[model samples]
Target: MIHVVFEKANVEALRKSFELDPSMDGEIAEVQDDFAVGPLADVDTEEGAAARLQWWKDILAGGHNEGLADDGHVDDQKVVRELKAKLDENPEEIVWIWAAQNKHDVSGYYWLMSQLTEYQGRIYILYLNNLPFINEKGNIFYPTNLFQIQPKEFVKAKKLARVITPSEFEVDPDEWTKLCNEDKGVRQLEGGKKLVSRGYDYYDNELLKFVTKEWQKGNKLLQQYFSKSKEITGDSYLLWRLKYLVEVGKIEMQGDWRNMKDFQVRLPGTNAEAAETTSAEASQS
Candidate 1:
């Protein structure tokens, strides 16, 4: 068995808790660039790879350079190549994909299925986005991914994995292409059978309001507010929006902008020149 997970955090969590059998392997296929809003093709050729990389570069460099790296890009070719090699090497090995309902995992799932059009190996999916599970305290919670479920609950999910039918894979290739080309945010696939990427930002305005309220009190880190909010999925996206706010003069920072730990938010008003001039008159300590 080879478990393919959609997020790096889920992979790490599973590795720490659930040990793979001696004959099993683990792979991560998270593109980390699904927020794109253009046509994208399956990364089976050099041309497709180049196109995806260029898209990533253009989007990241356009005013979002402070949060996400100016050149931060996902190597889709490497991930696809590795998965193909593994499937070809062991045609009988089962490929178990663990994905959630969110944009990241859902997009990755569709992309992987598109790549495995001619694969002979068996493929299974553990889509636990809407399933309910009990935690250690006996309270039921609907987890987004395997990372949130208890270790013992993972065993149950493994037992419930469903094999991907030939029809499902066949229908997904065209859907995948359509989804990649859509100029919207990737969220849920329409009708649970077709994939679509009509974008939505229902949480950004609320997140900005929450952060502004918190900033009025004192300094804060990205993690501090992220841990408290359940409205957003990707932390990087929120940070990117914050950096944009800073660039537009809606917010100001006193420390290194790249490091979230050093983030100290304030409204732009006081001039640095005035503060420098008054330094001698302030307390020395």
Candidate 2:
């Protein structure tokens, strides 16, 4: 009975709209298990939740990120038309917005959110980076479909907006976060880094392949190793582990894995700094 365009998720607008007609309160929400199938808990268990999270991570990698940004087609009018055509109903304004997968790709999905959320009941979002990202701050930088990095504060604000309107995809925020936290582990992806941390070795054998290779090639002191984490673009878990090691002083700044601020190089290393860095780099590889 209620139609919603989730693009401009401003509470003020909703308040005005509701005041105008209380019966017509609704919103187009990000695509989530709850949105399509009623509720996450009703149909998805912890294991199902974990599998869902893992699927999200795989799709949000850089290659997919860039591809969607440049080529994603978000014709709001067209979406509006399509929705009317598909649902066979036309109730009100259509919201448009892009939804990123994770906090990592929020910056990348800002512009897309606007263009996509421009229709009624069209929660158009791409599942990149394993988390949905669309927000007011995203509106600022990605104001007119421009691509660039926005801050986390902006994302938080958009989240609030969606919360009030209640994305058809709504769930217990704490429960959702818990699911994300647990599923977002080192082994979620295939053949990236072999996490050797305590109680976190989903891909222990795979991790050994790369780490042992480096060790055989003559590296040492492989504590807290991360040789097979994720395969996403610059956001790979291996790369993150490398940065983490550097932050903790497990490695220095030179050799095959020189810790240039660039931090994208991957080569062999004999020194401890290079060895650790190299190991980190190998995780992504």
Candidate 3:
């Protein structure tokens, strides 16, 4: 177990690079050099000097997660805008984004002024993938990765790298597209390929097909569904529609939704009860 706290000075000093948790203000007073907190050679050597030193190093390195000044990261538009300018001037100045194991990626750039403590002169950035996500009936939709990253330039970089949206950096959508339609088999995060030619088993296909079908049915309806699922599809209509279709055998499933095959879909049975509910949802949406 490791414990570390970021100092107020650190947060205030590097507010440009990222946002700080307000909770850390009262807890930590000042920043301690990695060496100062590293190991207390003269203190009780319960863990021994070597172990303690290493522990200090771990604290410094891991302190970012613990709210250390050097570990501050954020997706602030202002900071990103500055970075965008810097990148525009000198893309080569950027070395690497602040990447951590199992942590969100934070992009970094070189600086001579040392405005940001964490990214003062080296890599400085947090991976930003937060787009206004719209989740409707498990099918998540958003304004596109293009709109996710701030300043918009980041989106260009991602496209050039052929990286998928945040959670799916390494996925090769192009390759996945080839697997199924050899055209639309694009991939999702973790190398998850989406296909239409008997692609992605049944459940995945069903979800994709359902979404695609909705899109194809009518652009107006699709817009309504995405802009507000509860409004257009009704609060419970989408779920009940799915149930109705599944129960009636209009859509067959070999297994779970993620792994299904040979399925068809049908609309829900609309009665006074269902109509009233859907009407209410539509009005709200």
Candidate 4:
């Protein structure tokens, strides 16, 4: 059996779980792309894939992850192909796709399941949606991501695995097709397996709400925003949006733009010198 997960953190957690119970041992595969954001138009095609890659490159061009290596989509396709080959090699083998109740995992599930229609019965899903799990502190809480669950709890999570239904195989791919056709920039989980689309600027207003007239370090601002906002996204993406806000004159920026720590941001029309002086005085106090 092969255990498929969506996040990097989940790979390690699942590996730990495997050690806890030898019966659940299997090869782990990670689908390394966040499909919840970005363009999905013709993503299955080479041209469309290239377009999406370019979009990410543009977003990271002048931001924190500017030079980060990113062949994620290509790697994900290879992972899927390898999974199919393994399944063909051994008819008795099965795939267990573990997903939490979040847009990232669900979007990845939709994207992955669409390609595995031929092996419907061989694929199983253990969706941890609205499910209770015991944490390391012996408290009961619901998790939105697989990595958040304790390794010991995963021994029980394995019980939730069920073969992918034929109805889901037919209906879910249609949903993926609709998402690709709509080509929206953001996708959100309404409930269960349902996803809703939103514009590229969906989080723009939320981000703006955290900005103050006083200058704040880029990293500090992002930390505060993440702690306060109900909706959270990758810091790289949020930093990219902050740079966009600066570009459009919605916010003012000071210092270097290359790194989050080197930059400071504030609402437009604020006195930069006064803000800096005030910040220095407050720090001293």
Ranking by lDDT: 4, 1, 2, 3
Model 1 bad stretches (over 4 Å): 16-48, 54-74, 185-203, 213-230, 252-254, 267-285
lDDT of 2: 0.33
Best by lDDT: 4
Candidate 2, residues 1-285, lDDT tens digits: the string is: 223332333223333434445443454432211121111221134564444444334433332233332233433334434544544455444443443332222322221233233342444332223223345544433222112223343333233333212342332233333333444333122111111112222333333334421322212322224333442223233333443444555433334332223223222344666678889999989
Q: Model 1, range 200-281, lDDT digits (tens) per residue? A: 4544565555554223322254555667775555554555566667787776655554555555675555555457758956
Whole-structure CA lDDT of model 4: 0.90
After aligning candidate 3 to the native by TM-score, how far in Å is the CA of 122 from where it should be? Answer: 7.2
**What lDDT does each candidate get?**
0.61, 0.33, 0.29, 0.90
Clash pairs, candidate 4, are none
TM-score leader: 4
lDDT of 4 by residue, 101-137 (tens): 9999999999999999999899999999999999989
Q: TM-score-based ranking, best first?
A: 4, 1, 2, 3
Model 3 segments more than 4 A misplaced: 1-92, 95-125, 129-184, 190-217, 224-285
Model 4 residue 40 CA deviation (Å) reads 0.5
TM-score of candidate 2 to 2 decimals = 0.24
For 1-285, candidate 3 gives per-residue lDDT tens digits of: 001112223333322222233321221112122211122232123344345444433433421222332333421333444644565576454423321111111101111112233233333233223334333344434432222223223322322222113323223323322332331211122211221222112222233344422112222323435564321212122333343445655543222222112232323332545779999999999
